[model samples]
Target: MQKYTVLLLINFFLLLANYSSAAANDSFTLGVIADCQYAEQANKGTRYYTSCPDKLSTAVEQFNTLPLSGVLHLGDFIDRDFQNFTVLNTISSVLNTPLYHVLGNHEFSIDDSLKMRVPETLHMPARYYSFEINNWLFIALDGNDVSTYGWPKTSKRHKRNIALFNTKYKGHEDWNGAIGAKQLKWLERKLNTAQTQKQPVVLLSHFPIYPENNHNLWNAQEVLTLISQYSTVKAWFNGHNHVGNYAQKDGVHFVTFHAMLDTDSTAFSTIEFSPNQLVINGQGRQPSMVLPIN
Candidate 1:
């Protein structure tokens, strides 16, 4: 009987040790919401344009209760009218966690005069930037950097991108944009730094670079080629394909989050990251996923 008691105590202590080890890991959670696309306009097809403010409020309220390191909104905060940002801003202001933004093409769907003001309007440090949490590097890419809509009609980039789109991506939607040479080089440098430090990376973009979808980034292959070379890049999180998608390639998970503007359900997610895996706890229309890190 004494031997059995000792064995039981040893097992209990081992379990406690395991739990403590897990707790000590640099694990963290982040809230993710995509394509809120709020506007005062009426519903257009499946997009409940007017429902965004309330939906975002509900998501923010829920996030406030969670121990989130930050909350990332994967762009398209408004469907149109620049004034709509005011209403969305009010809703996002109450979030207790740090809010991060990624630029979406629709964010530029306003007067050309307001185009350059988008980064400032969204409170983004830059159109594309990087931040680190618990040794994990999160790189945010501005896919709209070389787009048709984000620039004035008379701008050289606008004309060049339009011409490029007409020539190569004629069958695909022109709404998609690419990471320009400068941004691509910058991304390479960031990736190199992460790799040297053995830090895992999570890329945030408004466009997906996988699965050959029409909603993919204009230079999807180029981005894909670059990312595939880096084993430190564990995942790519994106929006713009409101339907949502997931694909795994070269040990990297490509996740396209569902738009909050679609359906009545309202989509959002919280991702818990550990040393070994990611636990994606989805809310509403979003689906939960468990992705293991290699």
Candidate 2:
């Protein structure tokens, strides 16, 4: 009887030790789905527009089974039509966790009068906003704010964007956009607050800000410079180029997730954030990589 009691105490101690170890290594996972671009329209180029609904369904079903803190759709949730938002929402409803969105340029493809309605359709509180999960701050930026493609031709903002594109960034076209002065100030404030709180940040946008691609944001350099100024900023996740890309600048990881609209296969990812590293568990066409955080 005494031997059995000793064994029981030993087992209890072992279990307690394991629990403490797990608590010490606590990590969180985020479900990432980019560029669903769902529509009833037929395929265009490599984008299988009609396949997105089914693909999103699969992604949601899979994400529901994982231990995700939340799910983030990087943008371009629809291709062109407003009607496609209904389909995208229905498919995304299967997710058991909270879902967040970033506004993509394609979201404004509807009539100029209805351009502001896109955020409402997505149920976002604002065009750009911030949220927190597990001691980390996530900022979602609206890359279409100063773009010529989404605004009415006669609008001042549209004209200004066109002029800026033509004069300074002639190489970039209407599809790319810049972050206006107001948004830039707001972003700076958010970063300052996060730094004051000693919280790490992950930025989300629809337009890529690095790799010097044609699909990059019109003011990529400005955004990159702002982000580089903040040591608390750890990663920038985006989606615009369907091919996908990754880069690291000033200890910040810039990851452009592959578009879910491309190919019949689904493209999504589960990103696990630990104290030392960021682990990406990619599904379908999304490539996996583990990045060390400074």
Candidate 3:
């Protein structure tokens, strides 16, 4: 009986060791910032537009000290001026890891001629794309794909935006945009592939699709429905509402990060990803969270 008990204890320690090794192998950390909206403009309401460059510089400095896999900037890089992107770019150039950008409505608030240059200026591979890190799939979505301001007046997306605004989204905020049908189909395919591979998905966007708010995406319901069908989707991270919000439904986390442009203080976070959980270490105004992936 004593030998059997010793054997059981040995097995338990081995199991714990295996679990720890697996968790450590799959863990990685990423930096997150939203709405750094840099511009040489007067503060509008709570948004301190000019403070962005300095804040972003500081944030990058802090992020440089960390062992981060990457950093995701959830759009609104500039308030309006196309020139401001250059200033913000210089500040973020010091970041030690790869930087990802999501298309935001405010990114389109420039001259009609420069509208098409937004993606190129940001160095995005595509308006919507996906990448893998630590066996986890990260999908960056362009919520502005079908929006009133994101596309040129002659484009089909611009026309579709007008039709949706006039009919389906009459009461919604015009500043919020939608994921176009083509993009939705593409997302579906990606999710399907991820599902087949048993890979967990983390969606990155500039617009929120859950919690039923005015700042939510124009086609939030459709997006929600589509994502719900895929069990592999673990979380959706966004930033458009400066105040920030969080909600969980159907085991998916919907987190709207606080905007860096909202106040005099800063907002950003380091998200540590593990096999079964995500630990968010929020800085300044952002709140930390522990989300279980199971």
Candidate 4:
């Protein structure tokens, strides 16, 4: 509880100094990137992707040039590696701002034999975690692992909960996009804390949280129920779809963005916020769209 309490206290001050009530202005810039998907040394036949560290390096250069608050990568930072995670590690060091992430399917390509390799190359203190930024509780969730979930059904103490999930979401995407029971519990605690502070929540996950919105989380309904319980969740941002667009349910917004670099043709989104409204601007593409982040 001390850890949780201390985390809350830290965010309280951070949010006060960072968050704004000015309504999403054309200022207070942040970079929205995803699916950098860098692979080292592509084969002779593959023109769709090139193993270009400089491409990422260029992106870092762009980040450094821009006066931005931070960067959120929706995942797939690399196309390969477990034991030797060269691609992501290289990019992590190059970027000068705070980097936040969600897990793409590629990040979990490692086998248990090489399980020692982790998300740590980015220097994240915790893998699945949350933080407060500009009056928002941004949650970074891992969407590819569910077998290790410590849920009620999997935990034996809550057969009823397991039965409920089995009835609704069994056999979905082989059940990979799960929050598991433990993370859901942790989320509940976070939601309560955010609620008490009157802060809105934003979920940053590799997989989409809603069913009709996109690829759909393995346990989409389970997650939806959780979101419904929290009035503070302002939106969910994702990037596996590789196509830039928006999805909305009631007041919650979901934005699925395109990849960064992979074929010499990629995209990056710029999100500008002030106080109430947030605008996501898609760049380096034909006929870009600007979406309201509220």
State TM-scores per candidate. 0.92, 0.90, 0.93, 0.76
- What value of lDDT does candidate 3 attain over all alpha carbons? 0.92
What tens digits encode model 2's per-residue C-alpha lDDT throughout 1-294? 999999999999999999878755568999998899877776888889888888888889899998789999999999898888988888887788989999998898877777767888898999999999888999999888777786777788788878777887787777878888899999999999999998999999999998788888888999988989999999999998888999998999999999999978889999999877899999999999999989
Off by over 4 Å in 2: 1-26, 153-155
**lDDT-best of 1 and 2:** 1
Q: What is the lDDT of residue 220 in candidate 1?
A: 93
Q: In terms of TM-score, how similar is model 4 to the real structure? A: 0.76
Q: Write the per-residue lDDT of candidate 3 for residues 233-289, one digit (tens) a residue.
A: 999999999999999999999999999999798999999998789899999999999
Can you give the lDDT of residue 203 in candidate 4?
A: 87
- Candidate with best TM-score: 3
* Candidate 1: Cα lDDT at 100: 96
RMSD of 3: 2.2
Look at candidate 4 and tell me the lDDT of residue 294: 49
Backbone clashes counted, model 1:
0
- Our model 4 lands, by Cα RMSD against the true structure, at 10.5
Candidate 4 lDDT, 222-278, residue by residue in tens: 888888877788888887765555767867877777766534544776676654667
Candidate 3 matches the true fold with a TM-score of 0.93
lDDT, model 1, position 28: 93
